[model samples]
Structure formats: structure tokens, C-alpha cells
Target: MASLLPFQDLNCFPNPHTAISNATDPINVGPTPSSRTCFPTLVPKLEPLDDLFEPQEQEQALGNIISTPNPENASANACAGIPQGVPMEDHVYSEFNRISQMFWAAFPDNVQQSGDDNVSNSDSRAIVPVPKENTQVSSVVVATRKRSSQRVKELVRVGDIRIEDERHHRAVVRRTRMVYDSLRILTPMEEKKSSDDSAKRKRPRGDTRAAAMLRYRGMWLNRDKRIVGAIPGIHVGDLFLYRMELLVVGLHCQTQAGIDYLPASMSPNKEPIATSVIVSGGYEDDIDDGDVIIYTGHGGQDAKHSKQVAHQKLEGGNLALERSMQYGVEVRVIRGIKHEGSASSSNKVYVYDGLYRIAACWFELGKSGFGVYKYKLLRIDGQEKLGSAILKHARLLRVDPIFSDSTSCFSLDISLNKENTPVRLFNDIDADDGPLHFEYLTRTSFPHFVFHQSGSATGCECVESCTDGCFCALKNGNEFPYNRNGILLRGKPVVFECGPFCRCPPHCQNRVTQKGMKVRLEVFRSRETATGWGVRSLDVIHAGAFICEYTGVVLTTGQAQILTMNGDSMVYPNRFPDRWAEWGDLSQIYPNYMRPSYPSIPPLDFALDVSTMRNVACYIRRSAAPNVFVQFVLYDHNNLMFPHLMLFAMETIPPLRELSLDYGVADDCTGKLLICN
Candidate 1:
């Protein structure tokens, strides 16, 4: 009942049975014909390859065939028909047989023969029916084949994913584990103890007893013995306990320490103690003492020397003496005695002879042909016995019971005789006769109406001495210029005093210049010299002593220039008498006293015109050998616009000596010595 077709008309190759039957003679198959193929009656219409096996069924059949050991069974499984319950179609069977034959032909070496007759024909067919709900079943065969091919290609390329030799990796892992284990081995208590030991090693260790002693200004205090170690670098101005014993420690030169030759074994709690063996010879390259008071001198030089002698060079020692004269360097006078007996019996004693400041030092050739080092020290005032008393008396003299009011006049002492006899006023002198048309300002009062004070209204309220905290003293480095003897310290500037608003008492040490003139001075007319006026001192004036001030009208440069052009001279015009015709011009007589002319005028901001009415300062004559010079000063005021012109003694002047000042001239006025008969 089925249509028959030629063997060439089939869609696939011949069956495996046919191929095995004619093994010797191979039949070459061609393309399928259009006409139907002739075959046995049991054979039905052959269906298409897709109709015979779905994609899912084909994938399963292929997996089973590859896994099966028998070649006949694998071929049968790959070409299996429909599900078990469904009737088999002749066309489906024929198509399956063709495909199996072709698969076996393609891989003939993989095929195997099996002799199992008990295996059912249906069981041999491994194909199963695909579920109707599985819509993606068509792509299953392609996806599986692709995945298999990819796996094969990857294995061929990479060989294996895991590392082949893991010995190095294992070693690294073992070392890391050992490090972690070592870190965790220490306990918290052990770690803390180790840290504490490290801190102990870093801390400094010293004698416990010495560490317990109090330290002040670099000196260690031994409270039990009431003694202090005088380590190096101790300063002169520094203050220490009044009654403590000083143990002088030696420097680079010597290790031996003893007090001047007196007994050092005994303790003295009453008076302050000191040590001998003054250290010397430590000079740095810069030749400066680092601004400290300490300085070194020639070791073998005699301690006793005159005040004027300053410079000396050493025979064999460091050149530390070269810088001893540096200004402001403090000097310590250590007095001691040296012992001559054995070390056990011998004792040295030392004492402090007050403090002194270095004034000068130098190197000079000595009698021994070698250079000797010399230094000159000025005794500090408050430290010396006599100096301290003089300062106390000076402060007492400054107090005024009469002028209790703030605006009251200052006290003035006028004397006629050398014994300092008081007089009310001068007889011949007239205020109108002076060149400047201004009233003279005596020590009695200031010209308060013309110039206003410039500093803060609040004044210092120091009781006796002005400390460093005092407003007036703080402005001037906490130092009062005038000494106990009422003498101004050399090389100091104009100092200010506490103002009326100050709370300090009238007798406060800070009120030196404000107390007015202390020495006796007089203004006199000279008939012999053409310079009609001159000032003289009745009492002896020491060097660096304060003198009277030069007071006049304070005018600006513009105002002064106008007055000069209008024939108003700033200074008194020189008048030479006929008897002094041989002296030529007044400028030649006093060559140092040259005044500014019209052509080359001086550039001064403020000029004090003493031409019309002036003080006794205008009468002070010019001399080649002068003893005083003018200094700029500010009292309780701070107005720098018009500072006061004050005069101070440059050198010592004896009684009845005519006071004079150098006019700063270029020519030598000392050349012509005149003898008055």
C-alpha cells in the first residue's frame, strides 16, 4: 500500500544493514531523485529529517550515543523513533535509519560491536519525546554542541586553570602565618612592661640628693649648709640671698677651689661668703662676651692697681683682655687671702668687695718687656658703702616741704660766696637788656603757659626708688641717670622725671632733674674781653654733672628763617672793643664759634632764639678748653617738637673756674695764648 521509490530517490544515505551486507563492494550514493523510490512493502513514506527527530530529542539521543559502549546500540539510540505509547510511522523509521548510518559512517573508528541479544530494540533507542510546552527546544541541540566545542577548544589552549607548581605559594602563606603568630604571642602585661623599660632607658639619671636641691638663676642652692655653688656664667647685676656662702667652681684653667688664704672649713652664717681663685682666659673668636658681664683678665696681674690705668697685654695667655673695655660689662671685685701651709692645715678665705662696671681696658708694653693686660672699673653706686650713703642724702635733699602744690615753683638756691651764701637776686642784670625779647626761666618754675606737657597724665607712684615697673624708669631701661653723689652717669641721654600726676612722693629717687640745680652758679660781666658776659661756678663741679639749661623762644624753621631775614639774630652778636683790634674778627678770637650766614644756613626745625631776653646760659663764654656741652632733655613732657636744651659738665671744674664750652670750630683756637697784664 505504500509508494515505492528508487534507492537514489532517498533523502539520506543507505542503512547500516545494507552497508554491512555489501562490505566488499562499496555503493556510491547520489542525490535523491524526484520520482518515488522502490522498496519492500513494509517500508512506508519517508518523512523529513526535522519531522523524524525534534532538537531536544536529537540532543538527548546524541548524548546517549556518545556515552554508550556498543556501536550497534549507539547507532540504534541516535536513530530512535517517537514516544513509547505512540505508533511508529514507516517514514519516521526509514529517516532515522538513514541518519544513523550516516553518523556511523562519519566516525567509523569510534563504533564498536556488541553481542547482547537480551537488550530490547525499543530500549536501544535512546530518543525521548519533547514536551509541548518547551518552546526553546529547537535551539537545544545547537547550544549543547556549541558549548561542547568551546570546552574542547579551551582545554586545548589553556591546558589547566590551577597553578602547576604551588611550592612558592605555600612558602609565602607559611611565612605570613608565622608573622601573625609571633605578633599575637605577647600578653598585655608583657607589652606594657617592655614599653616601660624603653621609657626608663630614655630618662636621665643623676644624684638624687643633688637633684632635690633648689635652683635659682643657674646657681644650685644647698639649703642644709646654706651654701650655693657659684657655677660659671653668674652675672654682676643679679641679686642673691644676702647671707649665703658662695662656692666658686673652677673653669677650664684650674680645678682647685679655695677662699682667699683664710680658713674655709668654718661656716659663717652672719656675713655673705665668697671664694678666691678668680677664673681668667676664655676668649671666643668673635671678641664679644655674649652681652654677659663676665670677662677674663691676665691671671698673674696684681689685684691692686690705680683707677686711671686701663690697658695691658699678657706675657703668655689668651687675648681675652682685648674686649674687657666693652661698654656695660659688669665687674666683680673678689677679695681673698692665699694659704702657704700644707693642704690639710692651709685654708683660703674670700669676700666680695662690692660690684663694679668695666669702663676701659687695653694692652700696653710693661717694664718686663712683655705686654700686660690692664682694666679700669668704675664702682657701682648703690653697692659701695660711701656711694650708698651719698645717694641716700641726695634723695633726702630733693624733697620740698614748702612747694606742696603741683603747680608751685621749684626751689632755687642762689649763692654769692664760695661758701654757698644765699642771695635773693643779682644787682646789675636786667631782663630787658638781653638780645632775645623773652623772660628768663629760672629753676623756680617752667614756661607752662607756652608749651603743654606731652606724656600720659597718670604718673608713677614709687615710694623711694623707682623699680623697673615704674612708668618713668621703664622708659629709660629701669636705670636712674643721677648717682648717689648727684652726678650724671657718663654716656647717658636726657632722662624724664615723674610728672605732677605721679603718685610717687616728692623725694622719690626718680625725681633728680626735676629737683633743679644743686651746684652754685653765677652770671657775671667781663670788662677785659669784648664778649661782655660769662658764667662762673662757686663750687667745684665734677665731671658728668648736670648744669643750667639754655632757655629761649621755641620757633619753627619757617618762623626762624623769617626772623633771621628781618635782622633778628638767633645768638648774641659778637662785639669786639677797640682795645682788641689786633684780634681781628670775633670769629677769629673764637674760631670754634662760627654762626650761620645768609648764604649757607643751617637746616634746623626748631631754633631757640636767645638774642633778646635769655637765661644765664647765654652768658656762658666759649673757650678752647671747655668743660660743658648742651644736651637735649625732656622733663615730665613728651613733646619731641620742642625739646629743652640742657648743659652738663664734660670734665671736673674746680671752684672759681670760669665755665666754658667748645663751639665745635674747625680752626685751633689754642694756637694763640694771650697773657693779660
Candidate 2:
């Protein structure tokens, strides 16, 4: 499980499951002055009792620092110092109540009521004071609540996983994306802050990524159990931006080790077996040819000096591969490739290439002239197209769409010359026409709408472009919404962009979202029937790259509600998920950092009627974890109530990957398009 806790040694907590043995002795209750045989004390410390509390309740309950009686006096009754009239259970309960009161009083404003109703009602009850004789007794309860709370959350999150959901693929994929999105948002801010603080020592690169993974490690899926076959909900061609992401998804349980295996103790035959392997060109002797890989065994390298020092032995992963071959077991194969356009610190992207089996195994000398073990892994047949192959085809498509071999595109440009880059329409799934006929609209259609809030009429005076001190930049907390590379620095409640009335040029840096679509996208029928028609990019869309604006005819909430009652799809601005909040959350890294909050905008009563006149965003699918997010921008118009809904990439999206959004609606909630207020 070393992969499960990737940052354990790098300032993160120890192994997540390692119990804190320094905890004080448990409360031993002597038989209640009636029985001859003393009842064995069932201590909470010895049992896995943290799972007894609800996820939310554990956070509020575990925050309180409570002390327990010393282990030396464990043989005596807990109520030995209490008055004779009080029962043992009542006396112990009263003592806890008194301590809790003291804890809450220490930080009165920080108190959060427990989720359990019975626990919350105790605040109204009278608290019995500690006896004068017991005052000298030291508090012995250890600060193990942090570890318990983490375990509690892990169980709670795993319990929520549905094995039978049709959207299982989307569910797991989204969870991975959400965690990375938060990481992406924090890293840039951390780097910028470090650069400005010359007096402070600079943090090593990629520390934020490690910190984020550790902070939310409990919420990771597929870690509770290891499956030998294909991981349910994880599909071939799914791309991960980092190696840890593979751990998060349980694709490969090793953080750095190329091979992950089930130990002899875990295997049914009592023989270690290999489960998965990552081919990243780490060893020069290893060979990879599309469907087949000549994998290298781990060990024999001196990591401290970064070279081979000893000959390899068949004891660990090397032996496991031999056993897997004898058992005819399938192993998951993932290919890691260099990401030339990576925006994040990690320069490599990992692709899940489905399952493989060990065809043969032997020992050999390596390129470094040291003896090593080698295994031949041949890809199993009848799986989806290899992810690496799809990437190569995508590169060719971007270069010349017409020359690509596979027959899918029926129409070259669905926008009909509206957008700068043509949005291709493909339908190899079945004989279905494009989405219901709709007028091709590039901008939001507002009929004589005028809204003038405070500071809405003002415009920046930058002649060529806007920078740090420009009015537009100052409105965004003295930082431009995007960097010189046009990447978003952070998510804000509302981003002010250079408007038409501004003196800046049309191509100003501040007008990123205002520009028409740049990358090529396609509206195609998804192979997964549940998702229906979805949008996928034909080009690599980097993190924070402008995708498209949610454009259509605008309508009042009342009008939209009436139409919705008549069975019409209406996009509500408030219904869009507050995904940006997590994207900008700094509490994980800086507990005291009060994240910048912009002045609240007036209530948005407008809704876009994309049922008719619409853009490519109308086809994007809704997911709990979405790779694209809507950013509210005010540029085309002065109306604060009707801000343009611009969509941007939440991460570096690979080609042919379906784009999704967290449509901030409950699972039971019915149909509605995205909205962000």
C-alpha cells in the first residue's frame, strides 16, 4: 500500500492505517458493586469504533481535545471519586460532558454542533463538575482523533461507492478530476506566493500536488480492495495527468514501482502474483511495440546515486511475474508518455491501456551490463482501442482532419462558419441526425436588456493590453484573471474582462473568454449509451484554456420556470455546481489563509434557453467530477444580471475524451442545464 500513501515520507502523515499506540489506557469499569465476576472492560481504544460515528459527526466530535484517566489507576472504577449517590455510567457521562463544555468554551465561535440529535441536545443539560479529589488525576487521552477521523472519512467515502451504477465510469473519473482540479488551483498560487516572499525558503516544485493528494487521500476510490481483472468503472483510453492519479484510481497501487502485485499472503494459492505494470521507458533494455511490452523487473538499482550497482534477483516483483504467468492471470498495463504541452509540474501523462498477460519470462543482462529479469506482456484481445494509439490518431486528425482513415465525420463544420475553428460532427454509432435543429448562435441573445450595477459602466484605459494595475486587473484583486500564457491563475466568484467600451485592443489578454473557440471540438454520439450525445475535443486543451461560452437566447427565471413545467430544458445559473469554491480552497495548505472573497453579485434571474438557438456547450454531459467549469464573465455587455457563461478546461484534457461539468444538481433532481452565480 506504499502507493496508497504517496507522500507519507514527505511531511505527510504516517501509514494511514497505522494506529497511534501512544494513546492512554482505556476506561476500565469495575463490576457495578453487585456481580462477583468483573465484566471485561470493552475499551473503545481496542476496537475500531471510529466507524460508529457518521462522517460529518466525526469531524465535529473529533475536533475536541479530550483527556482520559491515567493507565496506572485503570483497575479502579471510573466513578471512584464521585459521590456515593451517583451511578458509575452517569458519573462517567457527566465527567465527559464537563470536559466537552470546557473544550467548546476554549473556542466558542469555532464550535460545530454534532450531527447526531441526541449528542447535540446534551448542550442543554446540566454538566456535573469534576470532584476535588480527582482534580490531581492527569488527563491521559492521546491526540489520536486526527487519525481516527481520517479513517472514519475513508470508510464513509468508500461506503458511497455504488457497484451497479450505470454512470460508474463517470463517478470514479469525476472523483479523480475533482481532487486534481483542487491541486491545479493551489499549485500556481503557492508558486506565485513563494516567488514574492524572498525571505522565506522556496518550496520544492510539485510540493502542492503531494500536499493535496495527502490532504484528500481518504476520499480516494478503489483503495479498499485490489481486483485482479479490469477495474470496474475504469475504461481503457482513460488518461491520467500524474502517476499518483493511477494510485487514486487503484489502477496501479505502487507510487513509483513499475510493477504492482498481490503478495503471497494475499493470493489464494499462497504464491505472489503480479497484478499491474507501468511501461514508462524507465529502463533502456525494456521494449514496447503497441500491443506487446518487454517489462523490466524492479530492484538492483542504487537509487541514492541513480545507477545500477548490483545484479537483479528474483525475490519480489520479479518472482510475482513468474507466478502470474504460471497461473495465467491477467495484469493491467498502463503506458506513460511524455507530455510535451503539460501545464502542470508533472511532464508525463499516463494512459490506461487495458489488461495484459505474461506470455513468457526469463533472466538476462541489462544495457548497464548487470544481470536482470525480463517478462514479455502481450495485450489481451477484445478490449477497447489502445489509449496510445488513439493519441497518435488524434495528432494526425489535428494536423489534417480529411486525411484521417477511420470513417466517423459526416459533417466538417456543424457551426456553419460561425466559430473560428470548425466543430466537427461525427456519428459512427448509428444512423442519427445531428441534435434537434437549432439556430447557430455565437453570443448570448439578449433583447434590449440593460443592467447597470455599481462600477459596471467603468472601463480600463489600457491602449494595447491590460496588465497588473489596469482597472480590469484591479477588479480581480490586482492580478490578471489569466497569466501571460492565457492560463487562469485562480477561480473567482466573478471575473471582469475587458469590454467593447474599453480602450484596450480587441485581442487584449483580458479578453480570453470573449474570443471565439480556438480548439477543434466534435459533437458525437457517445459509445456509452447512458451519456448520449457528448462533446470531445480533437486537440489538447490545457488547464484553464477557454473552451466555449454557454450561448443561447436569454429568458427570465419566471418565463423559464413556466417553460420547464411544460417539459422544456432551461439552463439555470444557480443550478451550476459551486465547483470553483473547491478549486480555490486554500485551507488544505494554509489553514489560516482567508481565501479572497469578491463582493457578491445581485441575484441572477436570467436563464439561457438553449433548447433552440445554442452552441457546442449544449451537448456537454453533467458529472459529479467535471473537467470543464463555467466562469461568469462580464465583457460583451454591461449587464451584471446577465453575465456571459464561459466554459474553460479544468485540467489538461487529452484528445477524444468526453468533456463533462458538475451541473450542481442532486442525483434525484430532474433535467436542467448548467448555471453559476
* Top lDDT hit: 2
Model 2's TM-score against the true structure: 0.63
- After superposition, the stretches of candidate 1 with alpha carbons farther than 4 Å from their true spots are 1-439, 443-455, 527-530, 566-568, 571-604, 665-677
Write candidate 2's Cα lDDT for 1-677 as tens digits.
Answer: 00001111111112211211211211111111122221221111111111122223323322211112232332223212233344545432232222222221111222234543112122221111122233211210011011211121010011123444426455545544554555555565656755764557534334234423432323334443345656656778877766655655567766556778755543322355677888877665577887877776777665444345556666557777766665455678888876654444446678889878676554544566665556777787788999988887777777777676347777778789999998877777876755636777888887674543434577899988886688887877777777656667667778888886789997788888878898889888876524368889987787667889888888987888887775556777877766655544545334485655773456788878876688888888877668889888777666667788888887668789889887777655533332211
Alpha-carbon local distance difference test for all models: 0.33, 0.59
Models, CA RMSD each: 52.8, 18.6
Best by TM-score: 2
lDDT of 1 by residue, 516-580 (tens): 66665655445533345466664445455667766566665676678777544453111111111
- Superposition error at 83 for model 2 (Å): 40
- For each candidate, what TM-score against the reference? 0.31, 0.63
lDDT of 2 at 19: 13
Compared with the true structure, model 1 gives a TM-score of: 0.31
